[model samples]
Target: MHFDLADLRLFIHIAESPSLTQGAKRAFLSPAAASARIKALESQLGSRLLYRDNRGVDLTPAGQRLLQHARLIMRQVEYLKNEFTAYGADAAGHIRIFANTTAVTEFLPEVLAGFLAQRPGVTVDLQERLSRDIVRGVLDGSSDLGIIAGPVNASGLQVLHFSTDRLVLAVPRNHPLSTLKHVKLKDTLRYQHVGLHEGSTLLSFLREQVEHLGETLSLRIQVSSFEAVCRMVETGVGIGVIPESAAKRHSRTMDLTIIELDEEWAIRERSMLVRDLDALPGCVRALIDTLLPASGAEPPSNTPT
Candidate 1:
């Protein structure tokens, strides 16, 4: 038996849509033509693929199996198309990168800028996600590379050292906590806090830590970025927890103080993760090399809190 990509494509469309007519519309084929294609596919396989109903169609057992393989095959086809297109476009390459807020905000700008400058033909698609989600994306082949901070379960991917940063308490210069060089999270929880907005990885981590301590964060204000949080703290709105890199940078120009967090989790080591280093395209590999530190170079230093 012989089947074409069109058959598999039509099968997937039919399986996903509420009706064959709708699927056919999406596939740019007439309803009758789509139905005929499905019938021919079923006949070739000698198995019923879908059960028709008034509302739509449901996949049969054989259809479900085929759906799985079809999705995988489509993914491979897309990859092949992109690879070939890059080759035809004068050695251009594309890389997809997913990173957490800390890595995106505090680390990647300079590194990515240099990488892009050196390799003019390479294009990057960058997305911001939580470290855990970044790990999942890399493992599922949705992302070519991931830069993450905090702890993550990176079991199946190759992990490499990327950078190191620390969480710090940012306060107005005259605030009570500013007098202290380091403080535990619990000690600062008693005061109103300026926080990153909800759904931020740093905010989520802070909330989880507070929950583990059987307490709640007394959030006075929530803002979208570290710069906003620092500004709020500088105006004495409330103390804020932010990366030391950001706090230090802001303190140079603002009346802000950075106090090191006394918890073990405060010192975060960011990591770069990939599904397989060896399988990366030449241009992608070159970009990776640029991101990595030179052999025997000093490890990233934590900002003075």
Candidate 2:
């Protein structure tokens, strides 16, 4: 049996759209040509891959399996391309990192700026994602490394201790919670809250934690960044939960009071995650070392444990 790479790619596009014409258009192929390729692929596999209707095509069991394999293959292909992109005359090194909102907004920018200045040939693609999603992306070869905050469920990956931070409540100086030294999120849930915009990792994590407490989190106002969240909270429109660093920084200038969260999860001990460091490219390994400064202890082994 034989399979063509183009056919696999076309099939993937079709699986995503579930419409032959739409898939063909996305793949930059004529509808008839894409149909022929898929039909030929089905014939080669001796399986009927699609069930067509006026609405769209549905994947058969075999097609579903193929789609899974195809996606995995494409991800690996992309990983290969990403790893090798630095080798050409275009750049010296390239790496992709997935990190939580705290790491992206509070920590990484300054560190990455220094790294980029020293290695002008290196370019990084940093993305803000949930810790769980970051772990998944790193493990699946879709991302080179993940910087996670809070507890980490690290299995089948090399874990390195990174940094620690805290989450605290930012409230207007005269607000009800302003007098408190420490408070649980549940205690503040009854009050209107300012929040980061939708799709933020911190917002999603807060919602998940609230759901576990058998409550819902409603935002009085939503803003784009942590600074914006603090600024809104200062106006007395609502209180907001922000990083302790951000709360402190903003309190210096804004009329906001910082209250530590009386919860274990509020103490965010960060960690770095990766696959086998021994297997990564030299420049990528250098980046990992740069990100994880020495902590007066034995260095992490390049080998995966």
Candidate 3:
């Protein structure tokens, strides 16, 4: 019937961490004290919160439910602290945004730079995550805004057209496919590929598309970013499939050739998603405005294909 903020904070830490000891360390509590707190919290709530095993701990159903509420509560607490602190000085705000790989790598830097330039007191926490994780973060109040690509089941969120891009092949100037203006993915699958890391959204999408065609991509090297992929392709390691914007930019600096893809799914669109636009803070709303494309202007197309 009674609990403190420390208990909730500790509970969240434990649920996220692989072990109670690690969680305790993160919460700045001794292991013994943290265990005692957990026991007391469970007793007061009349439910078990974690399942113990040799590998680590897993959250119980009740613990999962509590975690959702705890995150929301902590976010509100942070907002309150920032709001009150703003009155004593220049109005400063903090906004957290989670975006997928394409948006993070190609789009957000310029948009965020312009926003930060105008509001020197405000700070933005930007993180890169897959589209699905970004959606989950926004839905759970873990992130204030999200920009995602591809088809997303956004039944419960407000969606806006953010930007559009296409996937293209980046081949060395002398590669076999360099002479073609546009080639189908199936045609390119026969050669080795320089791809992004396994968990990257663009790489996963490419794999999914290849699988859908009853084929597999022969990836020769996997790198952390598009720049690395382009660099690898430039050295004749393998061709790379990357966002058109990135390929174009790197082509100027590197001896790489850009070839468009002839697949329908290659034309990707990005959308900005939020839980509720009406409920957003003024600073967040202003950030959204800055991110949105100019009125009556068509979304910038990344490639002619």
Pick by lDDT: 1 or 3, better one: 3
Task: Give me the displacement of residue 97 in model 3, in angstroms.
Answer: 2.7
TM values, all candidates: 0.76, 0.77, 0.83
Query: Between 1 and 3, whose TM-score is larger?
Result: 3
Measured on C-alpha atoms, candidate 1 has an lDDT of 0.79
lDDT of each: 0.79, 0.80, 0.82
Compare the candidates by TM-score and give the number of the best one: 3
Every candidate's CA RMSD:
5.8, 3.9, 4.7
User: Candidate 3 — which residues are off by over 4 angstroms?
Assistant: 1-3, 30-33, 53-56, 87-91, 294-305
Worst lDDT run of 10 residues, candidate 3, spans 296-305
Residue 58 lDDT, candidate 3, scale 0-100 = 90
Q: Report the C-alpha displacement of residue 28, candidate 2, in angstroms.
A: 3.5
Residue pairs in collision within model 2: none
* Top lDDT model: 3
Residue 213 CA displacement from its true place in model 1, Å: 0.5
